[model samples]
Target chain A: MDLQKMMDLPGALAAFTYSDKGDLQSHVLREGTELTPQVLDLLAHSCVANQAIASMEARGWEALTGQSGFQPLKGFSMVGLEWSVVVDGNCGVVVKNRDADYEATFNALQAA
Target chain B: MHIVKQLMAIPGVVAAGEYAYRGDRFSYEGALTDEFARMASILCRANTLSVNMQSEIFDSFAENIGCRPVQGWIVRGSQITICAVGNYFAFIENRDELLNDVMTIMRAKVGDVQDDLLVNLYARLGGDTKEALY
Candidate 1:
């Protein structure tokens, strides 16, 4: 794999990371937002989804998702039924219902 | 480790692998843990929301073990910018958890507003090509 390509994968996916001081930093971005889901998806695709498998397999990271974006790329393990993104004030709660029957994950944000 | 397995059960929770803070890998499972008592304490704290189910648990494990836990997630959106800092890792485990985290962060900037279009815009911004944050 091309070194540039390897690096580009992370770039394409919009992957991000944060520090302990809440001073958020991202590889693909300058600041990291705790509430954004789209960015998270991109990061997963590059890291956990496609490149992650290759990276892990080269060194060997276990396969979480059997799907084929990358043969070894670890797909998300779906354990719950409903996944909700609930926002309250400036804070958001990403909660999941363990039961497979749950549906709605987003509940109306409480009035500030 | 039942905790590890429980997290793997969630949907969109990729890379449900196990790791040791002192050892070698850390697995992230999406969604917040159902441990009401612990969650309640976190809830009582100001600006506490379940960024992801496993995020809190991983933090707790870190606290107990005296090792920092590592998590990674991607944020994609139309208006959102992706800026280059370094290698960014997400604390929230899965897609659902990441969505919740995004809403929580947006609420602070916007307000108690829920606009599907706006939400979608923000989400799209996460995947900004140049990686600009604003």
Candidate 2:
């Protein structure tokens, strides 16, 4: 896949290119890759993980996305650093930064 | 000199020194000596983890890799131990994983987005310093 095609996915961060397979290997997004019922469970697991962490720190948690209309999850504090991962498509993980260059890299990934 | 260089390589390890690991008590202070748990939070942050979650992760990782979590010091409520005859270590996986885990806990508290970028960049530079000593 080329840069534009790979960037088609919303919230892409970075792309890992491989060799030999001649295709994109991985694409990373800020939120998650899928909204399907299967992924809902994983997303919930991630939420559980976050809640567990909050319990240990005596704090609460929330979630965020890039979409304009998307209401950011409540209970999240705009305080310290945080990270989220989502597995989608050929991409093994998705991160938060969604710059043009990052998108290009994901587009350039080769198949392994 | 080597120890300092190695410790500095870890993402969030501010400092390390000649931590005395006698019997069960450990202490460090000198030109190249530091105490345990002093940088537990920092270390945990760097590794994308927190003090409380590290023990279970480490234990699972040890079991997976067929190693033991030895006794050495306590940092941020997690036990710091040397593995592989004090050559390698048994802690969180890497900086990216650690930072990711931290961000998960913080729930976007700070710069979860930026941190993910920085952590990935640093992790890509690649070379496990904490375990390199082994």
lDDT of 2 by residue, A7-42 (tens): 454444333322223233333332443222223233
Error of 2 at A98 (Å): 2.1
Which regions of candidate 1 fall more than 4 Å away from where they truly are? A1-112, B21-134
Q: Which 10-residue span in candidate 1 chain B carries the lowest summed lDDT?
A: B79-88
Give the poorly placed runs of model 2, Cα more than 4 Å off: A1-36, A59-96, A99-112, B1-43, B50-134
For model 2, residues B1-134, the per-residue Cα lDDT tens digits are 34434444555433333211121222222221222233322232322333213323433433321111211111111211111111112222123233233222222222122322223323323566335323
RMSD of each: 19.6, 16.8
The DockQ figures for the candidates are: 0.03, 0.03
Q: Give me candidate 1's TM-score against the actual structure.
A: 0.19
TM-scores for the candidates: 0.19, 0.23
Tens-digit per-residue lDDT, A1-112, candidate 1: 1212212221121223333322224433213323244433322332232222223432321133222232222222111112222221222223332211111211121211
Q: By lDDT, who's the top model here? A: 2
- RMSD score of candidate 1 (Å): 19.6
